[model samples]
Target: MSHGLSIGDLAARTGLAVSAIRFYETHDIIKPVRNAGGHRRYGRSDIRRLSFVMAAQKLGFSLSEIAPHLHRLPDHKAPTKADWTRISTKFRKDIDARIDALEELRDKLDGCIGCGCLSLKSCALYNPGDMKAAEGAGPRNLTAITT
Candidate 1:
């Protein structure tokens, strides 16, 4: 007998669509084995793995960012507490950086809104003469805080 849960069973346990599970598989977030009949079979550990992925995504982590951490774990086996502790240590650093950035943005946003200069090119605040445009596209002023 194949020693694992079917894709459908994994999806039900994780509250994820089977398609989403497949998506994570593509990113190396989970690796399911194939039964003799060629059906995908997920180990019980995949439940915790997918659960961790779900929580990480909720915290704004992209799959690319998460893949490296999970890849270090043993495939088809539950991660040890030490394994999770290491990952969380890294995540905490990222979370701290994001918090600092958010605080900076909050402090700056008030000043920008209060300045009452709707014109980007003429704003004396962060981007005088739209000089931030030289930095590249996307919310240049907001994202340029650390850059």
Candidate 2:
């Protein structure tokens, strides 16, 4: 049987600030038991949950998005390898989409810089003929290249 831990023990184990752990509890990402004196009591699974939360945050997930996934993990059972794989697949797809968008923006900026066109309407890099500029769909100015 796993031993129950105090909030301070959980914080020490996870290397997270006590307040951050408390914040996660408040956000419903974790639920610790209340002791007789009302101090929070955590369990072994809290370690795994908080680890997942920190990892998700490092990958740029918002607290709201991470909360649901953390909550879905079985409380009494550790997450299966398949569960992690599934979650990673979704995160990978999101990362790929962001990379593709960034690459496209880089290419467009390169084209704009190469052509040295200053006018937004006349510049192929900015205009794209579909009137993306008129619709105000992209970067407002060519200054991005310099900065």
Candidate 3:
């Protein structure tokens, strides 16, 4: 049987600050057992949970977004392969959208950089529709560029 670990040990293992681990607990991402002295005691499975939390956060997933998936796994149990597959699919979709947007932006930048159009009115980066500037200027020449 795997014995529970102290909060300090968990922090050291995960390389996360004690407060961050506490924040995750407060968010209900990881629920550690409370000892008689009221000290938090995490189990071995917490190592995986904390790793997932850190990786998800680095990928720009909000706590609210990651909560449901993390909560699906019972305490002291690792998430199943199917659970990971589902999460991976969602993450892949998010990544694909970001990649598509970046590619479009790259194409637009390439076109604009090579065009040598310094004038904002003729610049494809600034104006894709070739919109003429109004007689009176506003605060910013806000032109919507549709990809």
Candidate 4:
């Protein structure tokens, strides 16, 4: 019996479906080894890796965004607490920026619905005769966070 977890064990530990584990594998988020029997075998670290992936996805991070951080982790063995702390520090900054953006959008959302109603003075605060059209499409004021 070679030392390593089966794909099923990985999924069970992470509460992810077998298919979902495979999808993560394809993205190189979790690199499993093949045992002598040619079956997939995962390291214990994979549980934490998949758990991190699940949490990041819940926070609206794309696989592309999450991949780089995970890729930096050692593939053959468990990562140290320092390794996780370093990655988490980076993520903390990103999370803070996202929180700021969401707060800005929340605070300003009521001012302009971008429904082409320029009558309200609040509309002037944001769109101002659709000047945002020249800047680019989409909710310009909401996205920019100018105030």
C-alpha TM-scores of all predictions: 0.80, 0.69, 0.71, 0.88
Error of 1 at 44 (Å): 1.7
lDDT (Cα, 0-100) at 72 in candidate 4: 96
* Best model per lDDT: 4
What is the C-alpha local distance difference test score of each model? 0.82, 0.71, 0.71, 0.84
What is candidate 3's lDDT per residue for 1-147, written digit by digit as tens?
A: 145799899999999999999999998888887777887789888898889888888977788988887887777666678877887787787768667765666665534422333455436655454433432233123212222
Q: Write the per-residue lDDT of candidate 2 for residues 1-147, one digit (tens) a residue.
A: 144788888889999999999899898777777777887778787798899889878877789877776666666456788877877787787778666666666766645532333554456644455444453444544334323
Off by over 4 Å in 4: 113-121
Of 2 and 3, the candidate ahead on TM-score is 3
Of 1 and 2, which scores higher on lDDT? 1
**Candidate 2 — which residues are off by over 4 angstroms?**
105-125, 128-131, 137-147
Tell me the spans in candidate 1 whose CA falls farther than 4 Å from its real position.
113-122, 125-128, 131-141
Task: Report the number of clashing residue pairs per model.
Answer: 0, 0, 0, 0
Q: CA shift at 120, candidate 3, in angstroms?
A: 4.1
Q: Best to worst by lDDT, what's the order? A: 4, 1, 3, 2
Clashing pairs in 4: none
* Residue 15 lDDT in candidate 4: 94
